[model samples]
Target: MYEVVLVDDDVIVTQFLKRYIPWEEHGFKVVASFQDSHSALEYLLENTYDVLVTDIGMPKLNGIELIEQLKKSKSNSYHIILSCHDEFRYAQQAFKLEVFDYILKETMEETNIIALLGRLKEKLDQEQFTRNQHLKVTKFLERNNMTLKSKFIEKLMKEQNITKDGWWKEQEELLKLNFSDKYFTPILCFIDRYQEAINHYENETSLQFSINNLLEEIFTAKDQQDVQIFFTQGKFLILLPMKYNTREKTKHQIEAILKELHETIYAGFEVSITSVIGELNVKEQSLLESMRILLKNKEQRFYYKYNSIQNFYPISYTRDSIFQDYVEISQTIKELILKDKKDQILECISQQLKQIREKKYSPDSIKDWAIKLIIDIKLSLHALNHFERQSVVITIADQVIQYVETFEHLEYVLADICEKFLEQIRSTNLTTRNEDILKAQKFVQTHIGAKISLKDVAAHLHLNSSYFSRMYKKETGEGFVEYVTKTKMTKAIELLEHSTKSIEQIAFELGFENKSYFSKTFKKYFGMTPGDYKYKTKEKMN
Candidate 1:
């Protein structure tokens, strides 16, 4: 927009332009006009305007002197002179000064002013476009935050409390986002296998476009109406209203849609989406309190971690001492996950909740605390994959949480969680025992060229043959003879399928005493000789 500053030391003229002119319609801003040239020059030094309407004669500083001073200062003022007299000296001097097309103050015409402003409008338009482009570039750079990428990760970890499950509660209480009970549900969506998803787009600009396109596809999906998506940082925030009767049903529907879009439409990660509904009966005072919780709650994130659709009645989960119990349980469970104390994590959760109940804490409190415990573990699992990926004991502990509803449910996980943690913490030869088994497996694997026997292996490890055999069986669930024979035959199959090694050569390489014995073991394991197994596998592949 073009802005004009008039200098006449005439209040009447300034007032006339301010009130009568349709400056806004003409794409102009008449910010302020000076009553004297001294003040006008000072204002010019401090501010900028597209045009200046100055009379040739004024008070302490006349128009001609001001114009001379303005030009002497090398100012970029597109001056428009307003003179009462049409004098030769003034016109000659103004022409030399490059004063843009002078005007007469004796009778100021609307046509001249309007035409001048129209020309100024073109310049302003170009300036605005350039400014907008600059702003967009700035935003893009800020979003990338080259050096601060780690900062983003740190903040997000802190926000979600990679340790605590109630980080959402803190966020909800802190952000003060009141939705006016608008039928809104918060969505927690993230890229699945993020590292591999954008492998094709190695360039920064290209990768950004790919990520952005994926986001666009989410909104355009068939069932994505009534969904408002935002990204607080890297993680997507989805707001989809509950469209089904029960929370469970709605969760299933949301998961299905997110899964189909991610799995079918894209070859990469699903860009997982989750939805948590607001408490329908929460007091308005608690509106802000529940805002972040309802949005980022375990209910929403659970779908991402569990890969299951679960309806969490966050509204129903809130109770008296239960709230406090949930908070404490969540804290303790988080402490376990970080310390890598897998077993006690479960025992700690169950025992703490039990104590709350014994202390006359409401059953509702136990339930809420239990829910918090589940949520805590879920968030940690997001960091540390499944417990089976970690261990069977952890897997069992997790299994109990899902099915925990009665005393039997509580008992199901107790022994496993408590026993494992106790065993791990109390033991000192943990690494040595693990290393021994691993060393045995490695020795057997690498020594296939020689006639390696259990007695030979025991002698190498400086252990008695009987105890060594038993330890091997206990560790691998197979007797030494059986395990060695199985390993040799398995390696024989690989060689048969992918190598040109003859039967005799393969038997010798696998430490088999003879080809006939190798063939026997191979047949027992594969129900076929090495030759027949290779042929069948090749046929199946074809």
Candidate 2:
């Protein structure tokens, strides 16, 4: 139904006109009534009305004059003029202003004016309904555009040398506004324990509703003129202009407010907060730097913090995942052992476990750089083993899973394993069953840097040199000398790549008298000099 505004200086005339119309039956509502034209004009400046009815002969601005003046004000209202004369000239002037109807008070009855209004009211309702439809479509388009803004940001941020003022120049009409500010701000918010949150909510409909409803509330409460929020790469970005208070622009306090808002309102998941403030820089350079600080610092957070969890990328996750993958793969190995699938069971004994070989890693190593080969294998094994096997060997998979949850835990687990195994191997005697092979492996692993030959190894094993060489080749396909060099080179590369020791330092560590000879052997095994190999490998890494 159309909204109606009634204007007349006489209070009785206004009230009589108002009561005479059956507004609901006429498909309109009397939404406003004014005793003076000034109040009606004031209302017109701030509001939209479909129909304006006023008395033509008034003390101040008359109906015909008001209608003519309102045209200059960009008012779209249809006018109905009330007059007291039977003047044809007045009718011509009213018609000149495109007044929908003119009612002469000297001759018109209340029913006659009501009937005229009823016809116009129906047309007004139709126009209002159509106008409402356009508004709905426009709002939908605006929302859709906002959803894509995050994608635009993702691509924009990938550019190397972009500046704050660049996007405005690059495509001025794309956003339909000239940016007057010097720079833009980037904020990254992520759902922490996201997997856990998904698990906590069973159904997709409920989970989606919960996330969307909470985000909706936040956005709806704030002025959305310069704000945007969306998900990318399994995380959310609440990117908007960082508003500085005119009185005192305290960046730290604003950051704290964001943290507190997340904690109070969005308590379902933890958030990580990463923000770059100021128009001094609009590029991701500041975001990149801030992310470095975020990764270096550890903060304890709760559920609501998910919307605030921020980093330059999914890096913290990558570091934490290494240890988690190790534990998961360990669990798979234990499962295969329990199932007694001995054919590929040993093959599954965490073969990729070799990836961590002798490397001293802090909690931050291998972030966002671990190969898909590792992650895919881990995911495949996890999916399969979610309900796969019943283990018999008192599965330490669960224990190891918790321990290997991050690089920090990986180190602890490794040191713990080495410590426990060293004591166990020392106390537990090797049976005569393959005692020779165990002793030989121990010797090869231990004596790689020595100049000992097959004869020396055979003598140490208490076997004749010719017989020992054949047995060693039979037990391991490799001949005696190759085995020693290969083992030595393997350890040498690990030390070179992962440790801080230099080539000369590694020579002493490996018991090699000649560093040059050690270098030669390393080059032979890896197809490059140690220095060149490390350079090429590290360069290729990222």
Candidate 3:
């Protein structure tokens, strides 16, 4: 029920109203009655009353003055004024203070007061319902607009040409987007460790909404005229208008803006972002090309650490040699799988990844290679009668492709697949007695990028270190340390021979502390330093 407060300087008037009015029946309760306006103002300050009734002419703190004070405090109380005279000044002041109604005390009766209160209650109810409906409609439109905008951006990114310019214009107008400028610069902001953000929020939509709101606030502060579109995979595209005279100057300005954006996001959400700025392109036709280049540049993010800002450069396609490398790696992995050498298969995959990284292959190329390798492995297993049909394998392969984001995640997935494949092979009467040793070997190979110790591997296998070490040497004809060192050195050699990575980078990639130690270890193993080996390999290739 709506609350009502009655205030009048005369005690008789307040008492008569309180005793005679059927407030509850009219959907209101006279919560408080006061003899003076001072006490009523104090009560109003402490509480909220929806309807206020008071005498217009009082000694101090009159109805006008009380409402003026309440208005200063931003009160939303509907007010009714009672006066003994039909004074124009009093009615004008009451209307100015937005009083609900003015009643002359000489003609006011119980029926007239009750009718006024009933009409006020109906007005209040109608206003509240209208407000709630308006809020829901606003929220729905916001969600629908975002979805439509994202779709339009996705289409613009994919299609080479926008065939219906008028439709595009209509869409922009409908969405209230300002993209009429001739030149636009596309920027891709990628949230680093996106999966961690997803896990933190436990909802992808919530995370994306938060990021979008933050971006909008930052852009609005900077007075940037841009359109932000979000991808489902934690990437945001911002198409900013080209406003500066020179491209370099525009780039610098965008970098400054992005730096502020990065700092704000990190400070607020504790999430780091990497932004790649693409070259400027014309609005309608060249937009798709610029988007392609922007996405291609986004792949270079793997080359740098997180929380970086980089500019896009056109990528020169030289895929013949890369395709050849992929073929060779595919054949090697197939052979390793056929032999049921899980450790070697993982090592081969790791080396192939290193090669791809060193060659600066695009992210799509790397993903393609990974998908093809999984497909080849699945087909090989089917051919060997390990699986009766391809449906299950195909489903698993699709899941792996969908879920694998980082190289570490892919490594684990592929290792699990190899383990399952090995189990299937063993089901065909080919079982090894030294399964524990094999487990240790696989662990060491898969974790070759990390600093793995004998204790770590032994604990992984749930075996004693001393016994596992002896068993490993007996089975592999090499001690635990020797095998790990051999595996790392073999990978190092492959990198030095086939990749363009520097010796220092190779050393770090192989978990060596320094290049000097890596060089000494390489000389001891290959009878030459890594530099000499790399030079010799290059010379032989030439």
What TM-score goes with each of the models?
Answer: 0.31, 0.40, 0.52
Judge candidate 3 at residue 76 and give its lDDT. 72
lDDT of prediction 1: 0.57
Local accuracy of candidate 2 as per-residue lDDT tens digits, 223-318: 545444545533444544554444245445446646665674456544223332222224345543443342233221211222443323322222
lDDT of 1 by residue, 130-179 (tens): 98999889767644542243343235434532432365445434443333
Best lDDT goes to which candidate? 3
How many clashing pairs per prediction, in order?
Answer: 3, 13, 0
Give residue 283's error in model 1 in angstroms.
76
In order, what is each prediction's RMSD in angstroms? 22.9, 16.1, 12.8
lDDT of each: 0.57, 0.56, 0.74
Which rank order by TM-score, best down to worst? Answer: 3, 2, 1
lDDT of 3 by residue, 164-239 (tens): 5787878878878765555777788888777878899888777776777787777777676465565646788877
Candidate 3 lands at a TM-score of 0.52
Q: TM-score winner between 2 and 3, please give it.
A: 3
- Candidate 1 local lDDT, residue 29: 80
What's the TM for model 1? 0.31
